[model samples]
Target: MSTARFLQIHTLHTYTAALLNRDDTGLAKRLTYGATSRIRISSQCLKRHWRKAEDPHALSTLAGYVDAYRSRELVTEKVIEPLRGRHPDDVVNALEPEFQKLVYGDKADKGKKSRQTLLLGESELTWLAAEADRLAAEAPDAKAAAKAAAQWVKGKNVSVLAQNTALPAGVTGALFGRMVTSDPGANIEAPVHVAHAFTVHAEEAEGDYFTAVDDLKKDEDDSGADTIQETELTCGLFYGYVVIDLPGLIKNCGGDADLAGRIVHHLLYLIAEVSPGAKRGSTAPYGRADLLLVEAGARQPRSLAGAFRRACRPDVEEALRVLDGHLAHLDATYETGEARRYLSLAQTPLSSPEGSGLERLSLKALAEWAAAQVGTGADA
Candidate 1:
């Protein structure tokens, strides 16, 4: 007789649920069954199970079996239970053992059972149906309904990493850049520059770096009959992080693999804009580059805001020049109409003199005029 090998499908489900809720710290304890610890598998492995089991006629693979069990529980509890006056026996049977394993074990064993319980119930299915109905009711047409559903599934996570820094209100629009990567074998669109510029606050340590730059004095030298003057220079270096929603950017770029490359290249440009000492082709002494491109922008913005505040206008302008130069240097770069658009925006005036209500104005008017000129030059 052949021996039957049983892989713990329920245990896998419990672990997956825990992972979704970011409960990795207690995963080992949460997944224990009998005397043996359940083998740890990645969320990627679980995703493979879902893909393989998606076909209706697909054989009873481990993932498919788990998915079927989950679907039936949702239907029974959400659709059948209230109508039939009884809960599904299988739902309780499928969940109770794992509940006991999690709840009855040691202090370490008590993990995210409450979260797992919600997954096992009809709530998700109910919510999905309700959402679909709400969309249908609210949307003007069927196309709008479909669009809403598409956006809901492709929802993004946007974060602003502005910690203890006081940024000019206009900085918000300049910092809004996307990050994305190309799909395998996809042709990359030509890269474009995306500038991220800011100034540092006075209180922060990183802010001190820029203030030192501003305080540099001019040097002068005279020889024979001529006089010469030179301005002192300061090297500004600060640390900061840019938060991005990679998946969202990919969607926004219309799911084009080529466009995704451009988006990612643009993000790299933004990072380089803020970190002058960090170059793409350059290696640091520690074998690590000065700039760190963090995925999901996980680091807290508060931790980085101080460093960002140290970035003065000159530093930002220099960074933008570097970014533009890098894009022009790319051998395979393609013209994606971004450069022309940027140039047009940079040249366009914000408001006319009449709009400013200053036909014959004072020094404040002249100051505003000078500031506008500076702003246009900085953007250029």
Candidate 2:
């Protein structure tokens, strides 16, 4: 209902971490943001950490974070194997026509496995198997079932039909999205865009030499460092930004507007609380964003990360002052009247705009407010 296609989200965090995310060589990832050098973490690394995390607040099968696993074995492992002996004839035959087109599109191959396996979630897989089961039970024979499946595949947009019918197992598809490389038609674009996290100030990467002894060599007479390696590290306040496109999310999910909103709610909490697992054993760089700000509106989304281009002194008062000035400048230049809400959580002091209509909120309250933003837009 928001009429707008996107809900941009951005954050500024200061961390006291030591080598939070590192490269293959064990050096911290680095980037030049706005102009100055800064510690950095790749978007891919951040996403992998989120998907693999098991925290109560993070997405987990036990916690009911709706998701699917993409694999060729979905036809066998998820469906056929689970219902083996229960169905006569090859079970894969019963589902190929129905699932292949939806997942593979023009590159669909009935007898062969997908060139690139789709990471289909359990929810979608289960739904597909259930539909196949119904057909297997209804059809007089395997040949008949395959025939019926072919007819089922002839619907308008089989990809949309298969997914739209089943509420996605979780929010993964809606938030992170998917792309079927072999079949562009099966691609589901991700609504959220995360920028590489960078330090707020200019800093040079430092190398630390360290030694690791193998437990097996611990009692050996010649025992020395089994492995000697140098690792790089950097510590400082960092700025990270994420933009969520609301309407684009709905489109990817086949018009499930409510689901798009729910995914945002979960992501709001997940992004702030989660840390990338770059080098936990050697450098457990762990810290949460001390300052978080959420701004919602119909205005064109923009990142204020450039605010750190010059590298300001590390002080809470000064940081907030700079942010306030940037916000003022953006407001004056852009017809930002499209902005409807501002929710902020700050550990340090922040001077409020005299009458700018900004709401300072706790993190939980902010997430709740953001969760409810779906249906309400400029018209609502």
Q: Least accurate stretch of 10 residues (summed lDDT) in model 1? A: 6-15
Instruction: Compare the candidates by lDDT and give the number of the best one.
Output: 2
Residue 327, candidate 1: how far off, in angstroms? 32
TM-score of 2: 0.75
How far out, in Å, is residue 77 in model 2?
3.8
Q: What lDDT would candidate 2 get against the real structure?
A: 0.64
User: How displaced is residue 224 in candidate 2, in Å?
Assistant: 2.7
lDDT of 1 at 93: 29
lDDT string, candidate 1, 1-380, tens digits: 11111100000011111111113442211122233222222333323232233333222221212121122133234432332223233332233322222212222124334222212212223443344345444555445544554565342211111111121111111123212121111112211212121122111111111122323334444223233333212222222223333333333333333333333433332322212211123222011122232211111112222222223332333333333343343313432111110111122221211112212223233223322221121211
CA lDDT for candidate 1? 0.26
Q: After superposition, how far is residue 119 of candidate 1 from its true place, in Å?
A: 47
Taken over the whole model, the C-alpha lDDT of each candidate is 0.26, 0.64
